[model samples]
Target: MKVSVQGVRGSIPTSGSQTTQFGGNTSCVTLMEDGRMIILDGGSGLQKVTLPDPEVKRVDILLTHFHLDHIQGLGFFSPLFDPDKEIHIWGPSSITHNLHSRLNRFLSPPLFPVLMRDLPCEIVLHDVSNSSFEIGPFTITSQFVIHPGATVGFRIKGKSAVFAYVPDHEPALGPKGLIFDKKWISGFELMEEADLLLHDGQFTTEQYGKKIGWGHSSMEDAIQLAEYVGVKRLLLTHHDPAHSDTKLNEILDALKSKHTGQLDFDLAREGMEIELG
Candidate 1:
């Protein structure tokens, strides 16, 4: 199996010498298993990828939520309009509307020239119910996350390895203004012992405090969760738009020093690929 990081920036895309290394596009990733593809999130990063040819067959896209940065690439994804191709989308249901309707809102005329109903490819939307299900050779499971609108973290277990993706989650803060115990621990459990975990690390401890309940995690919080889960490798994702590559390196250096040999962690970079046995 192979996992590729197409984009990692959070909120919006940024451009500057400072962000050149890790990249400036929003969240999007591609996971390939047994000749099939599974796409996670659809941020600006999706625009960076070249979709497979129409004759190649359909793929699955599992979404965390419908935040603007997370779905901005939906209309730009080339394969969606191919007559011979199909795209299956799975995501948490919204309180006020179904997933299909929400997606339609984005693709309708005025918002975009092409309406979702007019797309040539078949688009199937499924409202995930927080349970485990099988998709080809992968076993997938999801859990609710603490975001403004409901969000979910996904764990995909293939024949030989496990991969977890959790973006835009706030490590629960208690009434006293500290990390909530249960929510923090539960997030770790969702990533426990995975071969690779791609997680949100969108703020510093100070910034996270100011944005409590805004649904994002700090670098320190991500490291602690990595330790708690005992994951072999943790890739810090959903980088803040204002963070320069140099600043990110500084944060990583501090994490490396603090965690030492307890956990393996690194910042997620666009174009990076990891292969599992």
Candidate 2:
């Protein structure tokens, strides 16, 4: 399996010399091989990614949520303009509305001149639950997480390995944190021994103390979760925009020193690539 980090930043994008190395796009990742492509999110990073497979005429975008940062790139995705491409979007439906209405709430009207109907591609939307689904060689499963609305995490089991995306989460994974029903948090068990787990590590230990219900995780929290879940590799992503490259490096170094063994990790940078057998 081949995974590429098209964008890694969180909240808003960043720039300037201090932020150059880590990149500034929100959240987009792609898995590609031969004649197929699977996109994880459409954050600003998605706008910059050129699909690895030129022969990919069919695309499936597995969205974790519909937060602006997560869906912003959908409007600019070049393939949406291609009338011949078959694009299917799968995501959690809000309690008040289905997937299409929820997306159109942001994607249409005065907010944007073009509507989903205006798009030339054969677009389809699937509102998903905590169930397993399939797209080509990938068996996709989703779970609910503690966020404001219907936030979810995804696990994609490909032929060679399992890759899970936890772009936003607020579980208390440490000793002092409050315990919630295991079933309420969908992606934990699905991530067990995962080949690669790209999870939300958007706050520092200190910052997490004050932002408990904000629906993001600290590096320490993530490390503990990764260790407990037996993940082989953890890529800490969904970086906070205010964190400069230097600050992120400091956090990365600290995390590496504090956690070691079967579970390994690195900060996810835009354009980084990993291969799983």
For each of the candidates, give the backbone clash count: 0, 0
Q: Write the per-residue lDDT of candidate 2 for residues 1-277, one digit (tens) a residue.
A: 7899988888887767878889989999998655467999888888876655656787788888988889989888888888988889999877789998888877798777789888899888988878799888888888877676788888888888999888888777445673445453446776778899999899999998888878888888787778778889999888999999999999888777776665778889988989876
Candidate 1: where is the Cα deviation over 4 Å? Answer: 51-54, 176-184
Error of 2 at 7 (Å): 1.0
Clashes of 1: 0
Q: Model 2 residue 269 lDDT?
A: 92
lDDT scores in order: 0.83, 0.83
Task: Kindly report the root-mean-square deviation of model 2 from the true structure over all alpha carbons.
Answer: 2.1
Candidate 2, which segments miss by more than 4 Å at Cα? 53-55, 173-175, 178-186, 260-262
lDDT of 1 by residue, 74-105 (tens): 88898887887778999887678999898888
